[model samples]
Target: MPTVDFTLRWPDGRQQRCTSPSTVIHEHFVDGQEMPVPELVARMRVAMHAASERVRARYGFACTGAAEQLEQIEAVAARYGGDAGPVTVVAVGKPAVPEVPRAS
Candidate 1:
């Protein structure tokens, strides 16, 4: 049950922090091996996109800024240390992807 915490900064100077269960991480690293920074960042981006989709579907609002905001994504922490109170920081930034209409 590993979790990834991240921060997303909007164009309007507003920031949103979110944590989500990392299925990709869990499925790939069930043996508790330390994940590479690049892989972690990629998985995080996928998670963020999924999250954004969920929010848009639930609220019926377009997340036009989400793609741009993802450029400012920061992987704050990953809690994979089991019972050791250890946290790993994999700070990475991803390039902005093309914006797509959320309303379907």
Candidate 2:
């Protein structure tokens, strides 16, 4: 299954990757006008933190698949800060191969 990815940026022109790739309600609708850069960055930070916290709370400090995902997410967050536009959610792992039919 595919998971959500998030990229956030701070006002100091810093970026960070979410510690986990999960969906978080960080989107906001604005009228016909440019969104304040600071506000937008703040929203992303909140969203990333919320999602990260939820994941950690659900799964303690364990080495599960989700845990690995979280580490990746954090790396992303750290790199992009909290101002990155919509974080791209990419599918991890190799593609599956179709099975061939065999005669009985």
Candidate 3:
């Protein structure tokens, strides 16, 4: 298990810090990619509903984290614990993908 600290800047010159039970945060290189942690947090309701369907489809268990996903992730992280290092940091301003050349 790994924990990542997400620093978010607010519009009114405020900053917020939150720790997430995520191994890594990957920015979208390809189109239509989903960043699960952000998505889960932003759209907890929908994501939880989908997650319920996900569990049901997988092990025939109908469990959704409509309001408990965050706590669950945190609890799991605590149970397994995590290493402090081995975390890769990507700059927010970096390019998502490499440029390609056309063949003549």
Candidate 4:
């Protein structure tokens, strides 16, 4: 199964490395739909939260104030060696300036 790796930095400058199976990563896009980097990051946050919840449920242990301590979450890497693979989604950026047609 594919996995999404990320790091979460706490308010105290502590960092926690976490990974979640791609199955838990939500479908943030539809057919031909696009999003921005910030939105993508938001989706990642949701996935991380879900992963944390799973851990809490299965292992019955979780970091205190984990939810509130989330200073930043960054997607580090992804592995797709098995049945799961990368997710294809368009991350839109600022619109390009229109080119002025020069006189011949």
Write candidate 3's Cα lDDT for 9-102 as tens digits: 3223233343332222322112223233333234434444554555566667665332355454334333321332211112222222435788
Pick out the ten consecutive residues of candidate 2 with the lowest summed lDDT.
Answer: 25-34
Per-candidate Cα RMSD to the true structure, in Å, reads 13.5, 8.7, 13.4, 18.5
lDDT tens string, model 4, 1-104?
A: 33444443333334455444433443433322434335545676675577566557766865333343333334321212222323334222222344689999
Question: How much is the lDDT of residue 96 in candidate 4?
Answer: 30
- Give the Å shift of residue 94 in candidate 1: 25
| Candidate 3 vs candidate 4, TM-score winner | 4
* Whole-structure CA lDDT of model 1: 0.42
Candidate 2 yields a Cα-based lDDT of: 0.42
> Is 3 or 4 the stronger prediction by lDDT?
4
Cα lDDT for residue 87, candidate 3: 18
Clash statistics: count for each candidate: 0, 20, 0, 0
The sequence of per-residue lDDT tens digits that candidate 1 reaches over residues 1-104 is 23344443333334455444332322322222334444545665775566556556766753444444445444332322223232233222232244678996
For each candidate, the alpha-carbon lDDT, in order, equals: 0.42, 0.42, 0.36, 0.42
How does candidate 4 score on lDDT?
Answer: 0.42
